[model samples]
Target: MKLSINQLRALEAVVRTGSFSAAAKELGISQPSVSNHLLALEKHYCAQLIHRNGRLAEPTELCSEVLSRIRSVLAMTREVEQILEGRKQLQTGTIRLGYSTYQFALPVISKFMEQYPDVNIEARAMASHDLMPLLQDGNFDVAFISAKSPPPEVNAFEMRIEQMVAVVGKEHPLAQFEMLQWKQLADLPLIQREKSSETRRVFEANAIKAGISLKTVLALGSWGSIVTSVQSGMGVGIAMAGEVTELDNLVAIPIDDNELTVSHFLICLPEMQHIASIQAIFDIASQ
Candidate 1:
């Protein structure tokens, strides 16, 4: 009831070796100390933990039960030691992060890695709605997403508040307009992200609210494709704030409707934040 873990190990060793002298030899302790631990455990529990028959010691039923628990405790101790060793491994190690292509998640990630070469990084492309669960399930250490809340299971950093904006090639006739109306964009071919993506979701909401319907939307596989299609004068694309807006060939006009704004989330499971590399990545992503 009130015994040390070492005392429990000593008791188990004596039972396993079936002799105080043998257990002491196995444990590299004096036979007397082994006897003392058995005595101390027996005294604390007020029960016979081990018994002698002929020259051999046998574990009692109580010792069997107690040793079962002690084995688990010792295994847990080993796990703790291994975890500490892994923390050292993370000092200059990789942190796997996930992100979607809608936001400028790449530029921020590339910049962070450039500034910290020792911090290796692995980035996976994923949808924002799915990134949270993968992070919480330990598939990724962290991920950037477009969400206001990261659910109860994940901790989130509100990285950037982005507005879904209509973008077009700089030379396109509509690109020069400072403001756009729903009717103006309705007839233009919309180069959109896959239906599951957040950018597409926001655009859908905006379209529904504005009572603007498009008979034909080019549903591209990736955000980049949408941008490419827009840049090549094939269609107009809507996206969150991206560095693509800085390109001389592209122009981004913010959508002034409630359906257009989405907050960017940098989400992580609570455990991964303890790793030095992950913490550093978090700090860098914020900047």
Candidate 2:
């Protein structure tokens, strides 16, 4: 018969406890069962693993030489079991997340963290243009991004459709208007997000279609920077609806064109959707 884990465990327990009856008690098996396992182990390996004298037992020299390795193997087995159990229970794991904007991603992230406080999260905010490639490269387990359509390689769940809007400082001349047309901003100094921004992309595309050449005075990398610049009265800023805070001394004016909108999606590689942490976050976002 081939060597088995039970045989190894019985041998180790007998050697450790110094008696067959004690080893049987520790292993939750009868003394005869422990003897049979040890006998089978010795017969298979052609080496006596233990020496017995009355109620006492001792490891033979050869068994002693390999005892440390056997203990290591059993320790590793227990660790593997614990890891699998933790994952199955959603008690431990890390999720790498990429986001274009926190406005949409943070709410879901907050809920996920609240529900699974033991799970670790690594969240990176980046330009919408950079999110897809990094997510595809396996740098992210999931991503929240703004796009006209989901890429073919990933699975996407539509979160919401956000409209592009003009953000002007409270004191700016155009802030008083309830809504504005794209052509109205053609002559104004527009402060925009970086060229990689999906908001900027949609706005420029719509402007081009409307036959308006915008005079963009500054291109900032972050939403805060655009808001700060606008607050300082640098120029009018462009942003997605619901992004500008009410207390920021800014007014978000809806643009007249419906085409100036983007769909936000929560996306992941199709195979990764089954991972517990990723699936948990997806469920939270879906709800």
Candidate 3:
């Protein structure tokens, strides 16, 4: 039986997203088109690929068996396209990169652009946790992250080290100090990032070493939320010193421990490390 790439993609998207409508939105096509692809695919194989489960679509047993192969085919297809494009050298191409922090990534990207003006760079700032899953899914070519460990699927090139700092409102009691000792933060209400944040993980590790349980009064999911909470006198916040910007009514004081530094890593799929465009970027970053 013969199957088209679009038909295979439609099946994968529908199975992954759990609904034809959701798959349509992801593929940037009409819902009817997604349905048509599936219809043709099933007719060609003379087998049902999907069955309705309430409002969602679940892949049949037959479809499930072939899903892995489909994903591999699509991945290789993209690789072939990249190889073909790489024949033109680094003069023209797109680098889709995700990042955990902008402070570090922006400068690197700025330098990269100056050297290769024709190359397109799409950079997005997202949480380190979110960036890794997307990278594993082939959504990003590379990522800039500050974390304790890189994911197993990707290789990391250590860039620089950064330390965490305690942030407080200008009028807060802790604001009087130039630098904060770890013990001082024990009793204070802390505005912390959610459990998934690398900043929080590093700060917590330090707090544990200081023999004090961190008193996290608020757990915010984003940096903006922590900033707002700290600014409004909700509690003190912790962040990497370089990552903190726009501190109008707040002060970011250094934490006492030197070991609280997080290492910034340039992460990408292991196989992609040798690509000319990606290597050029790594070379620039290494300089």
Stretches > 4 Å off in candidate 2: 1-88
Instruction: Output the TM-score of candidate 3.
Output: 0.72
Full candidate order by TM-score, most accurate first:
3, 2, 1
Predicted structure 2, TM vs. truth: 0.70
Name the 10 consecutive residues with the lowest summed lDDT in model 1.
74-83
Candidate 3 differs from the real structure by a C-alpha RMSD in angstroms, to one decimal, of 4.4
lDDT of 3 by residue, 1-287 (tens): 57789898899899888899999999999999999999998888799999978769999999887775676676556556755776656566788898877778888889999998877899887778778877765578889988976667677888888878998888888888988888788878988777767888888887888898778889876677778888888888888888677654578899888888888889877767766667878888888
lDDT per residue as tens, model 1, 83-193: 576564333555678887634577778777787665667888867776765664345767887754456666677877776777888788877787777788777788876
Q: Give the Cα lDDT of each candidate.
A: 0.71, 0.84, 0.81
Give the C-alpha miss distance for residue 42 in model 2, angstroms.
40
lDDT of 2 by residue, 1-287 (tens): 87678887888788777899998999999999999998888887888888888889998999888875665465444445546978555576677899988889999999999998877899999888888877754467799988888888788999998888899877888989998987798879999988887888888998999999999999988888988999999999998886777767789999899788988999987756656677888999999
Clashes of 2: 0
- Model 3, residue 203: what's the lDDT? 83
